[model samples]
Target: MLLGLAGNSCIGHILRCFRAKTHSSFTSPINSFQFSRSIYCATMASAAAGETRTEPVYFSDTYLFSFDKASVLKAEKLEGDSNDYAVVTDQTIMHPQGGGQPSDQGEITTSVDGTDVVFQVKQVSKAKDSQEIKHIGCFSSGSAELLPVGQTVKMTINEDMRRLHARLHSAGHLLDTALNRLNASDLIPSKGYHFADGPYVEYIGNVANEERDKLMASMNEVLSDLVKENIATQITVGDSGERIVSIAGLPCPCGGTHVKSTAEIGPMKVTRMKKNKKNMKMSYSLESS
Candidate 1:
């Protein structure tokens, strides 16, 4: 859908500025593709580590909560998703959804003497300019006027929610591993729906119902056994500059928070698998022990 402005080109730019699709009331694969791709591109091109830019703390420590103090840089009013404000900090521990994982939900607080001022982070994301990461939420005081630039804040993430997200995302990678183990690397991974409602990894291939059922059972068993094996999850930067997440030696391009080891993912289950015309959507879930 080519969205062009009839009166002025500036209007199109303004529309793009408010990237939230809430007002559009249109939901299509094409629109979703563009939105998710835009986030991916921003995540990839963001400020690199240790180069005089706000560092993505999750890149180094995903388990970190109550992260060290960070100076507030900018606060942009990002309307939509509850009239949230995009807070840019000198550094962040909240992981934005990228490369097929959901974003972290958390809060950041600043203290004065003994009094604490809090900011609830409803969503985390990177600005399209790739300059800084945005912790999108509203101030605890119900007004953005309280959050000012240069103020230092302490960050805290929702550990339980973050862990669940890690498990789900790791499950997605495990599913991809299962595909490769079956010599089905030809099923290129295109996108992923990692949120809790109905998470699945979309691949570019049509699979028969019978084959998908067998896959569900077999992959579930493998993931379960792998978790029992207690294989640690390792992360490293790729030659092409993508953050690679690997488990039991199988690697995948990912830029999202994850558990430290396969053991941390309590119990794995293959919940659903369905065909989307030409795409195969493999769904799964994690059971907490």
Candidate 2:
């Protein structure tokens, strides 16, 4: 769950959503003013020394974008039981690990009128209700005063880390498609799956040992062939609609980010495959050189 503003009454509600959905959902009320357009005016008009405005669009839809040069309109301490950290920014490139995926890690460099003062950024998260993203990182305690609300800052992501995540995530899609092909009618689409830090993935269902083997072999064959992989991503609302993409003969609706091609995932191997009492589980990790 993403952190909330301290002393804010919404803490209980935010925590409940975190437990129930394993996804961040903000429900706090913002002033009638539109967050983006009013940032500058709000910052100057506030009597509170640290008060600032927030824009939700900064976090909700950005899959890949640069925040290295974006400004900081607000950096209030978020309310939450955990003290790990949270601060809203004008714009960010870091992807928060939510929706079963892990959050992005990186740094934010703060400057005062073009002169570098301090660099901050360690953890990033999506704020509750606001849809704006937050970064929790180390900074000079005194530096907070130096970089007031509304000051501009530059953000950069750890590209290598992001690439690794993208590779594992794309592999997950392949695994899902492979399961569909093997069972045809018996296996169901993902009821639970994750492509996080360990790069671990799980497909839930019931299947026999022999059936599991055939599914694994089929997946390996596709990886071995090194067939070109292409992904087309789009946003759609609700059921009654579908998105299709060709992967050999597999097509499915997915909204997550993926590598441009399967070749980028080079030589994948299924390290572990087994079935629980009622569900078949597949575990995979990158092959060692």
Candidate 3:
């Protein structure tokens, strides 16, 4: 739930596919323009907005990449996007939390009878079952009442924050690639902590302290090579329809948002390495590139 102001056209192609499936006694919502899904984004009656919409995935398309504007599908306060505030849009550019990456925070603004209604988004999250993106936050200023459904609003993401997040995320993958080059792929990549606050990429490998420094130096070298090469980041689907993000140097399946190329990540430094009974953690942060 959130405190509320805010909220695509690629919907036509999707609607056609759904119609074809209806005649075949099968319906699937997994084929949005972004990534393949096993289930369609669920839609429900928004009590405040007075309309229904399939799950939105505009954020996944790097091209539609602008978090500039959207129409409000639903809006309610004290029961909205987050605790006491939130808004649901027909489609959203705001990236919701997923893949261990934190949600994006931003602002939404719309005109009501010539008055600007502003909604400050504090959080954006994706629900597990339906995987819907919810823009949760508070009204910076404007009527506290539920924003009328079908209203149009402008969106503005915190650019610096988004960049920081993307860099951390790409850095994690770069390290994964480095590990593979070192033939330590047995590290069996595990979970990832990509947030700017203490970002790290964890792996299943646990080596003695003597082995840690050697591994760190190798990873830094990979980073150096990546910068010099300016390798481009590419996205594609796997045979199983999983979203995969790959670099010229490494291959891995990742749904997290990333920069356009290795250079965009600038330079990164390996700060620390730690071992636990269960997992080995690689802590890293950005260096002035």
Candidate 4:
């Protein structure tokens, strides 16, 4: 759903900073595009060659912004692009776009002819039915150096952008918490669009039109109080290898990165609410800190 932020001029620059200029056919969330068949095959073949799956360091340590030695496994120029490339590495701290959160963007630096070169990581994604994560972008040296297989590279994500995304994601969950706390058991959360422009959570149920105003105000107040409490964010893995996240001591399965605590989510508000017969959308935004 498109958000109408007509009067919020300040939010315009923030949205621009996070917006990705992509050339894919369908473009909403930048990193969820489909890779070509050949690109997909190459990635799966590399995985079947007995190398281990890409190590997702972000799953273990969300605060780790840089890693010194990530071995490049496969790098190829994406189809229909002159200089754009798709890179697969032995491991990544860059979280691929999934689970309602946006992909992390930064640079992958490696030495070329005794000088440093960089691959600008604009989009990171998993192939439609594969577990392989592809880092898609162009190189600072153009196509002169598509990182060679087995080349060691240094990876760094934009720390500010990462923090903003994490906070926005956690704030969405926090809004869910507020709903439950306020005893709105009827609204069942089913989808979350945590993109920076207008992050919102969609639910499977509806609220009465007459009560929307009062309920929204209550949600905002509860969210504010919860943030002030400085509730720590907790992540635990279940026996089946599922990651469970908890804020305000209520747990839910999640795979996205998050802030260290709810306090990091400064202020949140349920800015707008829309409901049809069978579903509802609760639009929310974090107050600029």
- Who is ahead in lDDT, 1 or 4? 4
Candidate 2: regions farther than 4 A off: 1-66, 77-85, 113-115, 127-130, 140-142, 191-197, 226-255
TM-score, predicted candidate 2 vs. hidden true structure: 0.64
- Index of the highest-lDDT prediction: 4
How close is every model to the real structure, measured as TM-score?
Answer: 0.75, 0.64, 0.76, 0.80
Worst 10 residues of 1 by lDDT: 1-10
Model 4 poorest ten-residue lDDT run: 1-10
What is candidate 2's lDDT per residue for 37-58, written digit by digit as tens? 3332332344244544344332
The CA lDDT at 62 in model 2 is 32
Residue range 50-122, candidate 4, lDDT tens digits? 6444656576567789997689888887888467888898778888777777889999997767777788999
Clashing pairs in 1: none
Tell how far residue 154 is off in model 1, in angstroms: 0.5
Count of backbone clashes for each model?
0, 14, 18, 0
Give the lDDT of residue 70 in candidate 1.
82
**Candidate 3 lDDT, 1-289, residue by residue in tens:** 1100111111111222211211222222233354422212212332236334434443255434454456777776654345447688866766776666777777888778777788888888654433346778878678545378777778777777777777777777777656656677457666677777788776665878898898888888877787667887765544444344565445454555677788888878788989867888888888742
lDDT ranking from best to worst? 4, 1, 3, 2
CA RMSD of all predictions? 11.8, 10.0, 9.5, 11.6
In model 3, how large is the Cα lDDT of residue 288?
47
Model 3, runs deviating above 4 Å: 1-69, 79-83, 144-146
